[model samples]
Target chain A: MDRFRVAAVVTLRRSIADVQGTTVEQALHALGFRAIENVRIGKYVEMEIRAASAEEAHRHAEQACQRLLANPVIEDYQILAVTPAVAKEVP
Target chain B: MKFGIVVFPGSNCDWDVYWAVRAGLGEEAEFLWHKEESIPGDIDCVVLPGGFSYGDYLRSGAIARFAPIMGAVARFARAGGLVLGICNGFQILCEAGLLPGAFLRNRQLRFVCRSVFVRVERSDTPFTNLLQPGAVLRLPVAHGEGNYYAEPSVLRELERRGQILFRYCDAAGQLTEDANPNGSVANIAGVLSPEGNVLGMMPHPERACETLLGGTDGLTVFESLQRHCTMAVATSAVL
Candidate 1:
């Protein structure tokens, strides 16, 4: 088994209003950065798992996103990146 | 009828609901820990109370929905047992897919804590049976993520099914933008499942049950549940 690190990104759907994101956008506008048009804030989750392969790790990560990490009602989720963790070199 | 109040780790309103059910309403009630894998078979009603369950981690009620006790709660609801979710509990219900919609941050980007008026949209459900249609109730709400949102189609279906139990309204019982404390769509404050057995609402009825607390309107909701349970038992006995 190889150790894999995975990150899940979750964000509210476009149709749903994001009050926090909008607040942040307004704050930025107050700072004179008016060029920002669409700024949406979301959640980023990271975890490590032992899996046989990267594909297996990705599958497990997706399942976690579906079951607990993200709510499908008003948000969408994606497995950002899955890579094998490298072991430290012996001194 | 026995009422079971599910107690998540961060749940602060479990005891409040217990007290309301036992001393206030003089009904049998007990606290069920979140780790428990089973609910008492004799429990006719289950309540998911308010508070930051799991500290509202990963969004409100997002983590609490995965608690072991929720499995039993889901089973109970499937069996047509009455289930009520208030405040954070309502978010948990939505996260668990027992109800539709998700709670977003308040439109004002602030945590609102105050008493608000809500109108009984439908008096036919077990939760609102004691209330008259269009009756206005003053209930206290405390939460940041109480802005309820859903797809247009789902909202239409909810309306068509008469599932909306309560809506925020003015003192005169008019639904207006000013009356919406959290900017909930259609000023919705509470909703019942299609079956009318499960209810989820942001208002804290348990907090409003005592006259000493300046409001006794909340008691009517519990009284309605009691009445419904008694009739249900009686009908089953005859069957």
Candidate 2:
């Protein structure tokens, strides 16, 4: 089995109101940085999985996001990256 | 009419529900640990009480919904067994797909803990059968994430099916924004499954079951379960 590092990025759906993001945007505006627009905050989850290939690891990550990592009703999730991990030599 | 309270790792209100059922209401009740795979055969109603399960780490009730006992709870609920989820339990129900909608962080991002007024939007479900439609109830709500949200179509369907059980409102039963403790959509405080056997609410019914604690409006909720469970057993026996 290949060891793969996967990242699952989750964010609130566009239709859903991002109350926390709005507050953060207000704070940024008060700091005199007005260039930010639609400044939304989301979750970034990373983990290592045992799979045969990066494709399989991506599928596993997606399944985890669908089942538990992110709630689909109001949030969207995507497998951001998947890379095979290097094996370490035993001392 | 036996009641089972599902106790997760971080469940602090299991005893509250236990005392409310056995001592306050004089009913038979037991604790169902989260690790238990199946509920006892004679258990008539199951309650998922309030508190931070898994430290409310990822989200309220998200991880607890995967507890071993939940599979059995889902099976029981599908077979028409009564299930009630209060506060964090309510969040778990939604995450488990036993109920609709998701609870977001409170609008003000504050952990609100206090008593609030709610109006019974529907009295036909097992949770509110003893209440009258439009009746006002005073219950305590304590949580950091209680803003309920659902798709527009789902909200419309719930409205059409009379699944909305309770809503925050004024003492006069008016739905006003100022009276909404958590900015829930349409001021909704509680909802019932389409079959009406599963109910979830952010307010603490177990906390308000006795007059000495505060008000007894929540007593009707427990009393309603007793009435429904007893009648179901009697009806099955007669059949």
Candidate 3:
């Protein structure tokens, strides 16, 4: 299987109010650092998968999101391929 | 019987849950979205189906826990209504504080999807009234942040109250890491409230409702609820 890179980018839904983010925002204001606004916490994850082809890797990665990673309700995800690491010489 | 399936924006299992309920208990089911202020009138039970709600952004079900509809579900749960949360739904219940503990990311920090063995821990809860304790059932679990965590006191309390309903197990029904797919604190797979009215599990029962698709072990969850609720109503009528 060819090696592929996958990342599951998870985000807080825009519709739901984020109390955690709000508290952080409040804490920021209290500290008097007002430049940063609307801090949204999200998960930017990267992983490597061994697949026979890029399409195969993408299919499994999509299934991963559908079954587990990304919540269909409020999260969106995009799968991509990063340049593969060079194969080391076999001993 | 009328069933309520809550639909959140990122809830991927909403449709699958609807079909499972209909297939198990017949039609007369309605979907209540996360933004709604109330559950539809006289709904028999509520289901919080799985998926990455709000994209599992901050944490799985962390943001979805505060949805307007959850308030209604909270009220319904307090009134002793049957509620089951699968996967992300399970995470939501924990985040909402309707159930104890929380789900952290997998220790390995990877998404896991596979059929695993679940040993029914207690048959007393409304969610598991039909199964015998120690019964082993194979079910599908797909998740990234399914590691169950809680304060020591809460863990003891959960143990004391028989709130831990399902536990991950191996083919031999032995509790082992082989069964612990996500490194959950106690090999915990599901939990229930003191009243047994609310249940939350990372495994997807709806996905297991059909044998043709793969497995039907999940059907027992809904069947048990139906049986228990029907009996509860019958006994109440007699009184």
Candidate 4:
């Protein structure tokens, strides 16, 4: 078995308005970064799972995104990465 | 009528609803813990009151939807029982797939806590049966994520089926932009399930039940439910 580190990103669908994102963009523009546009904010979630294979870990992470991490009606989620955890070196 | 109020981990309005039904309305009411697997058989109505359940983790109502009691709540709703979800409870119902649409952060990105007027769009549902057609009721809404949204097609269906029950409006019942406290689409404030047995709304009718609480306009909602239940019992007795 391997311990896999998984990272997921959840964002509101493009069709839905992101009030926080818009507010931040306005603040950025006020600070002189006028070129910034379409600033949408989202959530990043990271977790560790013990699975037999990287593929199994990815599947589990995807299921978690579907069932709990994101609401399909207004949000979308992506499994950013599924990599095996590294062991620490002994002192 | 007997009302079962589900108490989720962070539920703060359970007692409010319990008091509204028991002490205010003079009816039988009880609290059902989130961990309970089944609802008591004699319960005629079930209420999911407002509060930051599961601390609004991940998203409002996201984690609370999976509670053990929710399975029974879903079953109870499907079996044609009366179920009402208020405020955070509305979020939980949408997350649980018992209601359509999802909430977004209030368009202004602020938590709004104040009384607003909502015009009743339909008077046929169990929740609004006591109200006159096109009645405007003053209710208090307190929430940060009450901006209701849905796909365009779903929105059309909700309108076509007359499932929309309430809309934010002015004192004279005009759907003005200023009247919409949270920027909900089409100024919607509440809705009914396609089957018409379940209702979800972002406002807290429970909080407005007593005159001392500011107004008693909210009592009609509870009164309507009791009227519906009483009529049902009478009809069944004759049958």
Predictions in order: lDDT: 0.91, 0.91, 0.82, 0.94
lDDT of 2 by residue, B96-198 (tens): 9999999999988899999999999877777877889999999999999999998999999999998999999989999999999888999999999999999
Better candidate by TM-score, 1 or 4: 4
- CA shift at B118, candidate 4, in angstroms? 0.3
For all predicted structures, in order, the TM-scores are 0.95, 0.96, 0.72, 0.98
Candidate 4 lDDT at A79 equals: 93
Query: Model 3: which docking level applies?
Result: incorrect
lDDT of 2: 0.91
Candidates ranked, most accurate by DockQ first: 4, 2, 1, 3
DockQ of 3: 0.02
Q: Between candidates 2 and 3, which one is better according to TM-score? A: 2
Which candidate achieves the best lDDT against the true structure? Answer: 4
Could you say which candidate leads in DockQ? 4
* lDDT by residue for model 3 (B11-81), tens: 99989988988975564678897999998767988999999899987567878988999999999999888
Candidate 3 wrongly placed segments (more than 4 Å): A1-91
DockQ of each: 0.78, 0.80, 0.02, 0.88
lDDT of 1 by residue, B131-157 (tens): 889999999999999999988999999
RMSD list, candidates in order: 1.9, 1.5, 16.1, 1.7
